[model samples]
Target: MNTVPGFRVISLPRNTTVRVHRRSATIVLTLVVLALFVLMLTVATGAYEITGNDLVATFLGGGSDMDQFIVLRQRLPRAVADLLVGAALGLSGAIFQSISRNPLGSPDVVGFATGSASGGLIVILLVGASSVASIAVGTIAGGFATALFVYLLSSGGGKVSERLILTGIAVGAMLASVNDYLITRATLDDAETAKAWQFGSLNIISWPHVIPLAVLLAVLVPLTLTMSGPMRVLEMGDDSAHALGVEVGKTRVWLLCAGVALAAAAVATSGPIGFLAMAAPQLARKVSRSPGISLLPSMAMGALLLGAGDPLAARALSPFQIPVGLVTAALGGLYLLWILTWRKG
Candidate 1:
């Protein structure tokens, strides 16, 4: 056995056990490779019936014009969007849960998802906002507003507690009610449009959404990676972090904002697509055997969950495609049940 600077290595006759950090990195790397394979699979298999050779050839710049148009123009963009959305939500969820030091302390728990949905609904139902740009703005504003509300109520303790959880649930329920009321006010056509978007389909995804999402991830990716070190320190408790020269209050706020940015961006693109933020971190922790909330593992899991689910959703009903959100929601429900029962037992 040998010890490295940041981690320990254990070598045995049959196998080896590396420390948590290295193990987590290995898990993430595996997930990334799997995600790439899945991306190619998704691009190749779709309703549009492109032969494998043609699809691969198109990817390599040799397919016919129609195959090129279908694969390049349509399939590739949605696949990229799914990956970005998953990574963003996964990273954001990991940060929030790690800082909150509670499994329940995710952006979804704090009402950011509902807040974003409320924002989009308000833009659509109130302002008759149909353009993508307008919806994106409203969704982000709503997320920020929700975070502000949750923070104001939950900040006294300097840590996430049951009160924060309860308050967030209350606020989320209220926002959901607001969404219902807004839907009531919408015209039938607008309501249909809003309903469809709310369910979260990749059909709305194209160049416009994909470009901004790429840029958003490019910025937040580095910021979240930088924050992970301090976040680990923060997990020890407020007094401990402060003693270690980490500004507890400022760090908490910045982490919350950063988490909200990632969550809000995902919500904007996918209409509060559920489950990834809530489940990915737990799944990552379990799989990587990490001592704490490993952000890289969570991001990789989120990307894999959502990215792979997209094609499954497409094929679930054969000729008719189901929204990927529903698939994740169903999976999340099962996960929640298992955790609850397991914990109780």
Candidate 2:
């Protein structure tokens, strides 16, 4: 019934009110538009170019056979995978940062991404499982196991945020070594396959890869969004959140599970693409100028970052292609330097 300067409040049937920040909404919309533009560019600018008209026509089932095959059968799946995986990483990063109350509280920074990779490697190299379903299972199992280990290790200390970060980093380092050992122990062919996967590429993506991820995100994204308010309340501290009727321990556990699942899904799909998880939430926060993490904005920013990065990875070297993960890692390193310098300044 009332409107504020920077937010719009809507009255609900049960005497409840929802306040939406105007600027955050604007920024989310802008990011979404940019993501769409990047998607179009990605589909249009490959070895066989598809003009704007042809791209639209292909989508509408009206393009020539060659155009349709290029757009529908080839590029669209990769673009969709980039978008979906980026969203997963972004949402996962936002959840972790919120839980740890640290900018660096990301799965990639912690141990979960490495754990997922370790799981996939064990299946691929040791058990010799080659199916996508099997790899996804391994990654999820590895991620959950790592999360449990980190939480148990960190539970003793009252400062969970600090302990979680430190434990995760240490665990991640060990897991990286294990992954390397696994690769080396395997046959040359298996090692080569694992190495390429570890670097993370969208080149091998297709509808089969995209469908399962899309379905999982369809369930997880909405579920995560519903917990956004409770997550923010938890950030206020245990005593305060308890006073506000939030079950601190239970909420934290559920949140961590969701976060780990999201990160694992991205890894299962794209082999631990780095920095997108760590950077998307922080970038979204800065752009929206919001004090707390906003899930929608983070997801939008993640999609936009990967969407933009995919084209560059494919076209930056003309004939030669770089894995999307390497590009993100390079950019993420630069982002870290800027953040450190900006803080000191």
Candidate 3:
């Protein structure tokens, strides 16, 4: 067969596949090493001195009951919680950022986290519910409803637009105020509990938290990964995306739902940990040096940051034991300042 003139046969590997795999490997390795280091540090702290041998022995299932109790029952759950929360936030942030095609389009920025927090707070305050199930349900509903509202209000003129950002900010601020009110009205005991949640703590986490979150992640994280293909396409500007056969609205909704589910689950379990969502994706992009949104790497960064940050916060404050959220909030605040200043100049 004769080849047609001016037609060159060239095989090109998809950039998306290569980028996803390379970024995923690097990020996952970094997260694993950091997670192990954090786990060791966590086991070493507190009343008992858990040395290298102790950690090894405990993990081998050969340590004393007391050693096992401290490692398994106490520190381990908290460490696991930190990792789970980090991963959830990282995935959620990447999804939101990609969908909105704005660096500031994270769940934290778009009010999903705040809305989740508000819903969890309502359960805590009005319903006086303390179970993880109740809180999770409330958070999922609240986060989803808020995003839908933001989408709708922003679409007043036509399709989903930049106005969604503005509406989300307004909605988030309002929900935040309500959260404060709930906190203020809580009884002393309830207030203490609510405060811990609002500030994002891993102190009281247990197997109960671990089980539900593990199940949620097993389902939601994979869904988030699968949706990344559509998100990447959607990032190429809306009109171009639609023209290329991408269902823009449907993709956005799916991404939003997955992101909200992940964020809401984290909020229900750990009470809206600070900036992991926003910070993780930014850090992942920097590390991977990949253009556009990097979901897998962002997740790895989230796990690394939270898993490591918890222990650093623990040691920095000693017996006081600062909440992980406070540490991240301070870090996030610095990042926010830098971003604002950079924009101004």
TM-score of each: 0.92, 0.95, 0.89
lDDT of 2: 0.89
What TM-score should be assigned to candidate 1?
0.92
lDDT of candidate 1 at residue 44, scale 0 to 100: 83
Which has the better TM-score: candidate 2, or candidate 3?
Answer: 2
Best by TM-score: 2
Model 2 residue 325 CA deviation (Å) reads 0.9
Regions of candidate 1 where Cα sits further than 4 Å from its true position: 1-20, 341-345
Give one digit per residue, the lDDT tens place, for model 1 in 176-285: 88998888888999999888888878875887888887898888888877777678988898788889999888887888888888898888888878877978898899
Q: For each candidate, what is the lDDT?
A: 0.83, 0.89, 0.81
**Per-residue lDDT over 24-86 for candidate 2, one digit per residue giving the tens place of the 0 to 100 score:** 899999999999888877887888966788788788889999998788877989899889999
lDDT of 3 by residue, 10-54 (tens): 344673232234554666787778777776677667767777787
Model 3: how far residue 251 lies from native, Å: 0.6
The clash number for model 3 is 0
Q: How far is 163's C-alpha from truth in model 1 (Å)?
A: 2.9
TM-score leaderboard ranking = 2, 1, 3
Ranking by lDDT: 2, 1, 3
What TM-score quantifies how close candidate 3 is to the native fold?
0.89
